[model samples]
Target: MANIPLEDIQNDVDTIVSEWIDLGLLKRGELFVIGCSTSEVAGERIGTSGNKQIAKELFTSFRKLEEKTGVSLAFQCCEHLNRALVVSEDVLERFRLTEVSAIPVPGAGGSMAAYAFQQMQDAVLVESIQAHAGMDIGDTFIGMHLKPVVVPIRLRQKNIGAAHVTFARTRPKLIGGERAVYSKDQAKSMLCD
Candidate 1:
């Protein structure tokens, strides 16, 4: 895949977020997980073609997305770091983050997530989260980190340059067994009321 322009990247992201909005997958100021592999975006296996330049473009696009949508960004690091997440201190405290340690580097944390680690104002590694929505670009495998009840999202702008992109918005899990009549509104509200 050729290096995509930042503007194009933003457009793709914008299209993605717009669909989430339509689906009630995300709301203003909600937390969203993003796990991107620059190598995959460039049509290579994840971590094989880590590129800081490509990472920067995607990060910029994410930042703009956050600013426009009022959504918090939670970046999932590569498996080298045990898939730890880089989140803001505010989110940490609000979510009662469980302390963890690791410095992300190329091939370990993947370039984009590593870049997030370096760029965070007050970064911390957390074990888990229940994000409202999430993007898994290049098969970063973020399902374990997302909230339960992952629902797939289809966007018109499919591949972000050869790397398949997938999105999810979670809903509450059904606790009781049979005879439990689920509230349609309750399930819908989990994604969007």
Candidate 2:
């Protein structure tokens, strides 16, 4: 069981989300990935324990954030499922992600992923995704899900409960060298062509 109270978890998640938004890491309609270990949050070794209550609290917080930000979430499952993600059908369709067949259970997928799989409407399992921004709680290694050119986004809350957390946001690959301009100037040049 998680020693951390639900309120504390909520507050931590809220702060992380707000900081990411302030840092310009998150935006509306972006795909955000979360890889969590309820066991780690509970102060136990990773994969040794699973806490549904903790998972629920985190999921609720994420739902509130999504409601306010319009950002979609992808919950990464544990290694038993090869770290596949639990995502909504809408996200799957929009990203053209390949769907796999595997219903996540607490032991196999970790509590967070299991909770997400159950709560999401029209949810599906995806083998991989290229998310715009991501948070890895408990060192679940969410890096694989993030897009190329990932930029680490530091947050005020370094850890959520006993779990260590890391965040990152993706950016477009810079194509040109020192003299080349990006963004507005590049767009103007393209228009001129």
Task: Please write out the lDDT profile of model 1 over residues 36-139, one tens digit for every residue.
Answer: 88888877777788888777777776876677677788999888888888888888898786868777787788888889888888887787787878899899
User: In the order shown, what is each candidate's alpha-carbon RMSD?
Assistant: 4.7, 2.5
After superposition of all CA atoms, the RMSD between model 1 and the true structure is 4.7
State the TM-score for model 1.
Answer: 0.83
- Give lDDT for model 1: 0.79
Task: Return the TM-score for candidate 2, rounded to 2 decimals.
Answer: 0.91
Candidate 1: 10-residue stretch with minimal lDDT: 17-26
The lowest-lDDT stretch of 10 consecutive residues in candidate 2 is 17-26
lDDT of 2 by residue, 24-76 (tens): 54688899999999899888899998889889989988887687778899999
Stretches of model 1 off by over 4 angstroms after superposition: 1-10, 175-179, 184-193
How many angstroms is residue 72 displaced in model 1 relative to the true structure, after the best TM-score fit? 1.9
Could you say which candidate leads in TM-score?
2
Clashes of each: 0, 0
**Shift in Å, residue 160, candidate 1:** 1.0
